[model samples]
Target: CSNGGLEGANNGKITVPAGVTSFTITTPTVDDDLKEDTEAYSISVGGVDATGTILDNEEDIEVSSVTSDTQTEGTSLVHTVTLSGEAEAAKEYDFTFNNGTVEDEDIGTLQFSNGVTYDASTGKITVPAGVTSFTITTPTVDDDLKEDTEAYSISVGGVD
Candidate 1:
């Protein structure tokens, strides 16, 4: 008794036509357990217009079972870095990262992109899924001998 129940059959359902009034149903970011009692999912909508009219709207997708307060993202999450001098052996060095507050960076550094990845043993740096912000391209070690300006420090602990 389900063709697109809970919007999970490959997530293929959402057609708007016949005057195009309005439509918007987007829900993402689900990770909060400790359920004491509260969880629901039911957004039924069968449509038909442009001569053959019929639109059913029985919406309801409430999920609120607090107890954990939502804070679980520690799959070995790591992004530690530190460097402030020592690079003048072969040349080729350029440091750029700040985090004054974010949105431009200045405090320590952090303004990543959409698809990120950096794991040198476990210094995890994977902010996948429509990344919000990320930027840490540490690569260019020449160590020739002629250094003077070196600086870097990125530390983002796991969110338990």
Candidate 2:
């Protein structure tokens, strides 16, 4: 009997004819961004048998192997996170950023009640006070500042 006609067997049991060899299962691409390392994501691959049967218990596969393209860098007031990786095609992925801190050098002294604004467009920091030395540890990107970090100097008599 041919491969297709085997399903019509009277006993509901069919024997395979010799020469039919191997089948392959293709893995789908996954894109994910995790804020913490312990996060898990599920991936599914279609094209299963008519009965939705999967070989080797391989249904609803778990994702493995994640890589990050960039890291967060800046002072205490702001930080930036750049990321890239392989994700499933035509699918949307959500990447979470955990609150983390980085080391920043003191450019000038930051006085109490002084205002500081980070410009995302030019990647520069504006301070409203004259600081002898100030360390920016957790700088974040804003609409004015695009890059991760910026440079600025403080004058003793600068206007607040």
Candidate 3:
């Protein structure tokens, strides 16, 4: 997980072991004042301690492609990370982020911004502008048995 207390900071690299098939990375949502810009942050994943070469050859997972839309000025974004390879079932992986910073804080929390919308049908929260980030810490179980229970704990940082 990245973007918690340390915004615009880098924590360095995380090592994933071999035989692991999938993993999830969590990033904290940011709440910030609207007047600021140029929030700098970065999250990187690497296979430093793996028994075999990391497949894909990509240095780190690209979060921008998966959750770019959610990083808007005043909205909370949730993104799920999954591996794309064949390995043992139920294997686990861990990812860590390089420290960084977000410029705005007042815009992060829902109460201060335009508010959020929950779509039961799509299972998504729509955040408005001026907010740096939003995260769902706990997710209610879906009506369908096929869905898994999910929870999120997020924090946003900026000028109050």
**Least lDDT summed over 10 consecutive residues: which range in candidate 2?**
86-95
Better of 2 and 3 by lDDT: 3
Per-residue accuracy of model 1 over 63-114 as CA lDDT, tens digit each: 1111111111211112322222222121111222332222222122233334
lDDT of 3 at 67: 28
- The per-model lDDT (C-alpha) reads 0.33, 0.30, 0.32
**All candidates' TM-scores?**
0.20, 0.17, 0.20
lDDT of 3 by residue, 1-160 (tens): 3323323234464444555555655545444322222344544445333222222222321112222223422334443322232222122222222112332321332222224455446534444433333333221222323322222333221111
Of candidate 1, the 10-residue stretch with the lowest lDDT total is: 63-72
**Runs off by more than 4 Å, candidate 3:** 1-67, 85-88, 103-160
Cα-lDDT of candidate 3: 0.32
